[model samples]
Target: MNIVRKLALSASMVALCCTAASAANLTVGFSQIGSESGWRAAETSVTKQEAEKRGVTLKFADAQQKQENQIKALRGFIAQGVDAILVAPVVATGWEEVLKEAKEAKIPVVLLDRGVDAPQDLYLTSVASDQVKEGRVAGEWLAKTVGSKDCRVVELQGTVGSTPAINRKKGFEEAIASSKNISIVRSQTGDFTRSKGKEVMEGFLKAENGGKNICAMYAHNDDMAVGAIQAIKDAGLKPGTDILVVSIDAVPDIFAAMMKGEANATVELTPNMAGPAFDALDAYLKSGKQPAKFIITESKLYTPADDPKGEYERRKGLGY
Candidate 1:
């Protein structure tokens, strides 16, 4: 071959390889709903790890419990032209416009741990635990324990507009509706934070008659439940005995509380949603296939009698 022809061929091959590499280096932008709970932090950790393992470039944005921040981050990701986007929405509403924009850009969006109210076709898939079932599990456990005993419950809800808070509350209420003995006397948002939970629980403790009318406490997450335990202690009440406590999210602290008999029951919301979300992303991106509208994860209920010490030890090692 002539030297000039050889040089031209080599240059053409180099350009083609560069183009292929650029196409293969999928850039996925992820907007997390801040590290509010142990479960949320663990989800973030696993997501980053998963992206690294798959050799995909990840651009992360922490919304810090603000909806405006998430909107801004979504816009930034759109401007940057990410191949795909993953959002753990801070709340369920006010996502229509941003999602529409992403869809117009032809970037697939995957929801993690929460579902959006937008049209399902706008987002590629949602990978989340069934909040309704989780709430029902807690309610069933409580009902079985209480039986026909009269129960006045104080509810510590999650963030107001969040899916977990809304769906969990609905499911729990539905499950306990037929049981006349189980009634929610007081309910308020704890914002899914420990401090908020403690503060709200304190108010509940100070309610008329020294919270004597309250028989149990229910929190949306384990952090809040643990906080409620502290409040119960400060109020000079026996947590597990005098006032039963139940919550969702089987975090390490909840396990510890269970071991100490300070908490009664919890429903596990595993933080491993990121791994399956990424798998869905990989499949869709590689094959041009559309994934399911929702991928529901299975969860379980935990109690003190369910190997309390082992549960505590195992959760402690989970880097919660």
Candidate 2:
């Protein structure tokens, strides 16, 4: 090879080696909340992909939707002395002690997709969407769609204490406060699972005069929405037509439902929360630059008019 070509090749090889070495030098621990829903599963898949793309050595732990399990996992990561820790908290409380341990260990903890009730100084930064805004979007759409019509809505809430559940419910309530016609007649927690969603929705359908009294169903996530759709069908009621369906988390299945005209609206909660989490970690580790206490993600509303078929195609391979 010519001398110039040899130099270029050597430089390329050096850059590649340096990149690999950099990634190898840092180890990150990810404590996921288990595959509680399609959205959560998609987040896990996307997180692993992001870590792989960055060449990061990712240590994973599935907490199975238990706060105690998550705490134990965090302790395990701390004992392992991983470079950093990423957590999708199952609940908002009871994290301060473990986080304090992480703080003492000097391992920066980054909360992904959810937040804890602990003090801000306990972690590095949180990367999540404005969950309340997501609810507001859903509520606003419902309000506008059924303007001046008395609408008795039923809500499928997420896990009781999780930040998304709390914030999303609060936001939806706030949005519909001005609309006297819209009221949440019955609300129940689905624990953010499809099976539980279906079970609770069945009860709601039975309670609300065989689902005739209900004007709409709003879920905290798409998985629950899909479950509710099945329940509505079992009651011999058309989902999107008989009872308007709106929810958060634009999972691919929800798009499929929308395509089938079984669901009405959904708000997008991007599952790639790890992308920004990694970005903040890289910046903080390299330059001691602190990312904002909260790294807010973007959310958008989706409906049948937005082309559900295309959306389903786009997200189907993302493990949703």
Candidate 3:
């Protein structure tokens, strides 16, 4: 080959090689919302597994359930020039500025399992379960289980002002709105924690005549339901029998509770939010295809008849 032709070909090959390497070395930063619950822990583990499967570099930061920590982590990711970012925001608002910075840096941001109140153009997409549907499913189960009987329900809600808390409560209320026989007699925020759930349930028990007047307990998440189960037992009441227990987020512990006849039903909030977020990111990065603004995950309901032991075994090893 002529020297000029050979040089041109070699340069082209080097450019191709560099492009391929860059494509293979895609780096993403993930800001997790701390290990506040078993479901959150499972999300972190699943996100890492998904990143590894895609051969992507994942830079993970735990926000410790603080918005400031999340903001700091996002800024760091932007400064590092990550190809993309995944954030399970601790709260819904106050994310516009940081997301704008990421947009200015030309880094795509995908919300995981939660969303922020930012402009649509600022984020690639949000991957989360239909939290309202989750709550509705739980409420429906309770309504069906009661079957026209007058049922007074006590609710253990998640963190106040959070998206999940708000939407889940809305969904449950919608579900039971037409059921004149069922009513939420008492509701309190459990902060999505087992300890807080227990404490809140204790107060409800005291306020509701030692749990006798409560026919059912509906928790926004399973962690709270599990905690409430202990509170029910402490109050010398049978949980699943005396007070039907229903909740969202079918974590393994809830399944265990179901197995022990402590919990009646639970709706699943799958922790594989990152899997869809990564899929959307890959499509956007590879072909410039825009995913839908919201990618809703499954909201499956489980009861004791669904073989809680099998579900527990399936999820027990997923770092939950």
Candidate 4:
């Protein structure tokens, strides 16, 4: 471990010791990647809710979007000798070494919402949505909407080289492969942040004839899509009518945008990933029955016609 990891581990050990129970009830430690987005915050909230609902002792650690923090948190959990560990990895690589440590400690580590590039045996299972299908759904929606009309697209990507970024891009490309009328004219990474999304979209508008050449915008997440919508309007162009904005993660803000006729569509990426993760952990702990290696949550495309107002109301209080 590095100096940062060592420092973080030492600090977290005190907190974990105070909070983590030593009794016989199931004890699980979770290392989250921080609340960088609405969806991430929702996931964290739901994870805590699920653990409470199931009467499990949950030790939560916020990694603040750093790999070193996650490593530190995992080591702290292992030292605590918690029954299990959960990790939402910050990145795909650089996890094998820490994961091996978890396995040697006999802790079944479950991954939430994201994936790691390490060997499968290091973790018990991963609970996430089918990210490629999410991109495909968004692409298909754009393709069907455009029909035979020529359309140029600009993509706002997630963290470059991340699994969702790679898979979602591949899936969208696959869906639009046969559509000669629709071409992605520009693409850039937005780092899956609202500010970065707006900044990138501003650049795209300036480069693509002030948003005239861009017929549609496909963002890897709804936060970026929401920010891009602002960029579209600031450029004196209607977002849904001029650019046909579409993205993933059906966050409440996106639905609110749809209700205002700003965003066209969004593919739902449920934040209740920990609901399934906890269920799998419960089963495994109680019966020694291993769950499937991959627990895929469902993804659905939501449009204005699907009662965007009602959807917004329903999701507004879910920590999004």
In candidate 1, stretches whose alpha carbon ends up further than 4 angstroms from where it belongs are 1-27, 36-38, 52-57, 63-83, 90-107, 116-118, 159-163, 188-196, 199-213, 286-289, 306-320
Query: What is the C-alpha lDDT profile of model 1 across 217-269, one tens digit per residue?
Result: 98999888888899999988989888999999888888888888899999989
What would the TM-scores of all predictions be? 0.73, 0.76, 0.81, 0.80
Q: How close is candidate 1 to the true structure, as a TM-score?
A: 0.73
Residue 148 Cα positional deviation in candidate 1, in Å, after optimal superposition: 2.9
> lDDT of all the models against the reference?
0.84, 0.89, 0.88, 0.89
Which candidate number maximizes lDDT?
A: 2
RMSD of each: 8.5, 8.3, 8.4, 4.6
How many residue pairs clash in all the candidates, one count each? Answer: 0, 0, 0, 0
Candidate 2 lDDT over 1-320, as tens digits, reads 23235334534544564565664456788889989567778898899889878877677778788887788778877886878999999888899999999999999999997778999999999998998999999999999999999999999999999778998999999999999999999999998778889999999999999999999999998888889899999999999999999999898899999999999999999999999999999999989999999999888999999999999998998877
**Deviation in Å, model 4, residue 77 alpha carbon:** 3.3
Model 3 Cα lDDT, one tens digit per residue, 146-264: 99999999999999998789999999999999899999999999999999999999999999999999999999888899999999999999999999999988899999999999999
Considering summed lDDT, which 10 consecutive residues are worst modelled in model 1?
Answer: 1-10
Model 3: runs farther than 4 Å from truth? Answer: 1-25, 65-72, 75-81, 91-98, 159-163, 199-212
In model 1, residue pairs whose N, Cα or C atoms come closer than 3 Å (at least 3 residues apart or on different chains), thus clashing, are none
TM-score of candidate 3 versus the correct structure, residues matched by position: 0.81
